[model samples]
Target: MPLNSYQHPCPGGYQIQAADMLIGGTLGARVNWGDPARDVVITAGHLVNNLNAAVFQPGAGVPGENQRIGHVAGRSPLRTYPSSREFLGTRAETPGQRITCRYDFAYIEVAGDSAATSYRIPGINDTDEPLAVRDPIEGEPVHWLGNTTGIVLGGHVRDLSYWMTMELDPTNAANRQYLSVQPLTLIEVQGTMPTRGGDSGAAVVAVNDRHIVGVHCLGGTTRKGRPFTMASRVPASPQALAEGSSSAGFDEVLTWIARTKAWVNS
Candidate 1:
C-alpha cells in the first residue's frame, strides 16, 4: 500500500495502479486513441497487459471503488524468447527481442469526464506547458519519481547502452537464473538511486530543462557491488523516433501521437 499519496487530478510524480499492482505516472490526459479522442496517460508497457487493463488510483481497493481512472488503450510490446543460446544466463533464459527491449512504454485511455490530469512533475516543471522532454545524455544530472522513492535528485546518466541478464524472480535463492535479456541499449543512472520494486515505470527527468528523458525500468549493483539504474529512452516525436535515438518498436503509439500531435502533450 502507499505510505503517502498525492491528492487527485492524477498529475505526474504520484502513484497510479493496475488492479493490485502499484504502477506510477500519467504524462497527461491528452492523446488521440480513436474516434472521440480520449485522454492519454503514460507508463511502462509491461504493466499494461489485458489482465490488468483497468487502472486505479492509490490502489484497487483503497478508500472506495471510484478510484479507477483509465484503461489500457495501447502498449508497446515487450517480447521475449526462450534461450536462443547460453550467451548470458545460466540454466534457462528468455532474451528480449532487440526491438522491444529498448521500448518500454504504454498508454491509458481516461474517461471523458475524469478528473483533470497534468503533464507536470511537481518540483521539476516550472511552466504550464507539457513537461519538457527528450532523451538523457551520459554524465548529465537527472531526477526521477515513483511511489517507492518520490523525487530522487542529484543522479547522473552513467551509461547509454548498458545491457543486463536478470533472474525471472529475484527473490528466489538462485542468482544465476535469468530471463528477458533485452535490447543492448539502455540509459544507466549513476549511483544507487534509492528506487525499489514499486518504481518500475518512473520517469527519469533531466536536471537541465527538467526534460522527461528516460523511463525507469530496473536497478542493480555493479559487479563490484556499486549501484546503478537502467532506463529506456522516452519516446519522442515521430521525427525524433525515426531519425533520432529512440530506436524502433514504439511506432504504434508514437505514430498515433505524431498523427494527433495537437492533442498529445508527450
Candidate 2:
C-alpha cells in the first residue's frame, strides 16, 4: 500500500550486510511474537548465519545515511528435525518424508533507539492484529517491497510443496542442504518485477488484502529452470547456488516462533 503517491516509505525492506559483502536480503518484519516487550526483526536465516553481519536501514550499498540498526539475535537451525529415524533414506517413500525440514529465517533484536515495538505494511496485517496465516493460492497475485527491487507487483503464486535447496561447489558437489519450513510447505512466486539478491527477506503479501503469505528467501530462476534475466544481480549468499526462487510460508514461521519461544532473549 503506497501512501500519497505510488511511492511511499515502507520500513521493512532494510539492508542486511556482512563485513565487506555487497548486501543480503531485506528485513522482513519487526515483531513481538506473543510478548510485547521483546522486539525482534525478521529476515532470511542465511543472511544472519554469520552472526556478525550488521543490518542497515536503506541497505549498505544504497545511497543514504544507511543507519546501522541491530545485530542477529538467533536463527532457526537449517534442519529442525532428524530426516530419518532408523536408517537413512528409509522414510523416502513415507507420505510426509520432508517432516524434518526447516530453513531460512533469522530474528534480530533491535539495539538502542532503533527498536520498533510494532510494525505493519499497508497490504499486510497490522502488527497489533492476531496472526492469520494462510496457504498461498496458486495463480493469485502477490506483492512485496525490497530494498534493492523496491515495489514488485503482479507476482503470481507458483508452488506450495516440499522444497529442498542445495548449495554446491563449482564442481557441482553438494556443500550445503536447506530444508523447507515443514513437510511440503514452501511458497514459490513468479513476479513480474524481478527480485534481486538483496530482496531475500522481503514480505510476500497478498495483492488483494493484508495476508503475509510468505517471506522471500531465494531468487534465481523459475520453476522450469529458466534464468531470471530481470534481476539486477544475485546476492553473494552462500546459499545462492544458481537455483530457483522460493520462500517459507507463514505457517512454518509462526510455528517455529512458538516452538522456539524459550530462546528469545527478551
Structural similarity to truth (TM-score) of each candidate: 0.66, 0.55
Give lDDT tens digits, candidate 2, residues 1-266: 21111111235655555343444567676655322335566666656655656665544564454556676765545542222221123323443333433435566667563533236643455455432324466666766666666555336654454333323112323433334443222333453344666677766666776555556765654444432211111112223312223333345444544532422221
Residue pairs that clash (backbone atoms under 3 angstroms), model 2: 45-105, 162-184
Note the clash tally of each candidate.
0, 2
> Model 1: runs farther than 4 Å from truth?
1-6, 20-39, 62-66, 81-100, 111-116, 166-193, 223-225, 237-266
Candidate 2 minimal-lDDT segment of 10 residues:
229-238
- Among these predictions, the greatest lDDT belongs to 1
**Per-residue accuracy of model 1 over 1-266 as CA lDDT, tens digit each:** 33236456656656666673434433322333323433466666555556337776655555574366677765554444343233323322232222234455666767652574565566666345555456667788877766566655446775565545343234545444343323322333455554566566666777877666766666544434445566666555423223322223333323323432421221
Q: Poorest 10 consecutive residues of model 1 by lDDT?
A: 238-247
Model 1 per-residue lDDT at 108: 73
**Candidate 1 has what TM-score?**
0.66
